[model samples]
Target: MIEILMWLAVPYIVIGLVFSVTHPDDVRSLEKQVQTQLPAGADALSFGAATLLWPMMLITGPVEEHCDVG
Candidate 1:
């Protein structure tokens, strides 16, 4: 079970690393836009959490667009 879970997670981790490194501009843009819009205490945590939980934001859409709706 542990091995299987590791296998599943590897791809996501690789993709996240590649996306973050390759498209830093998008991440920065999203971070800046979101900081102003997020609740006062949530700004910092939200970005890091969003990156880990929804790595696809690097491809699927802007982090703010996906994360700020809530």
Candidate 2:
């Protein structure tokens, strides 16, 4: 048990060491990929209501865009 943990921890410790050696801009880019793709402030003014009201359509497309609008 202890021997398996020692071997598993060795590479993880090496990875942590390498992460610390990485450049700051590269690290920031990595962190930014985890968030949503919204632009800075256009969401609330433009698409906030649409996004909140129709999350499914936002994720997927509309079932019929030209169906029945009078």
Residues 1-70 of candidate 2: C-alpha lDDT, one tens digit per residue:
9999999877765654454344333323323432245446433322332322233433444323423212
Model 1 Cα lDDT, one tens digit per residue, 5-68: 9999889767666666665655566556666767564545544545465555645776545554
Name the top TM-score candidate: 1
The worst-scoring run of ten residues by lDDT in candidate 1 lies at 41-50
What TM-score number comes out for model 1?
A: 0.50
Candidate 1, lDDT over the whole model: 0.61
User: Candidates' lDDT values, in order?
Assistant: 0.61, 0.40
Q: Backbone collision count in every prediction? A: 0, 0
Clashing pairs in 1: none
